[model samples]
Target: MSSQPSCSQTTPSSATQSIRPVSIKQLQTLGGASGDDDAL
Candidate 1:
């Protein structure tokens, strides 16, 4: 697999921009339902 950090794992600012347009719930799904601190 490629050794790349996911969008969610990127810097908060970058992640926010890259994930822009995606709803919080959608982000949460991509982030998973474990309630990870970075879900938001």
Candidate 2:
């Protein structure tokens, strides 16, 4: 809700740009989270 508007202020595309890389990094950090997806 409030957080969405905060990150999206600069550009509509910035929302995806900000989230995708960080989301991948977070999953990688979480260990088998990403690995499990790859294995499947």
Candidate 3:
């Protein structure tokens, strides 16, 4: 009598961490391993 589906999931250390600071036009649109494409 147990089909299974009830874990509820919320455990990455209670999840909520984003100090948010990534701008140089968003790291040049993040396409080249993001170091502003190796300073072009």
Candidate 4:
């Protein structure tokens, strides 16, 4: 699961650079759907 950290890092950076709204939405959905996984 070493690749998991890389994926987690890349996802937020890419999202921040590309789409703010989508990132916000994804975070919101993740927060609502899963409390623990929201750390991603």
**Local distance difference test, each candidate:** 0.67, 0.81, 0.44, 0.86
Q: In candidate 2, which residue ranges exceed 4 Å CA deviation?
A: 1-10, 32-40
TM-score of each: 0.26, 0.45, 0.17, 0.44
Off by over 4 Å in 1: 1-10, 22-40
lDDT of residue 37 for candidate 4: 58
lDDT (tens digit, per residue) of candidate 2 on 1-40: 9887876786768777999999988877877766777889
Candidate that beats the other on lDDT, 1 or 4, i.e. the better one: 4
lDDT of 3 by residue, 2-39 (tens): 32322223333234222123454455577556566688
Candidate 4's displacement at residue 36, Å, is: 43
lDDT of candidate 3 at residue 16, scale 0 to 100 = 25
Clashing residue pairs in candidate 3 are none
Ranking by TM-score: 2, 4, 1, 3
Q: For model 3, give the 10-residue run with minimal summed lDDT.
A: 1-10
Error of 4 at 22 (Å): 9.3
Residue 8, candidate 1: alpha-carbon lDDT: 41
Number of clashing pairs per prediction, in order: 0, 0, 0, 0
Candidate 4 or 3, higher TM-score: 4
Off by over 4 Å in 4: 20-40
Whichever of 2 and 3 has more lDDT, that candidate is 2
Give Cα distance to truth, residue 37, candidate 2, Å. 17
With candidate 1 superimposed using the best TM-score fit, by how many Å does residue 11's alpha carbon deviate from the native?
Answer: 0.4
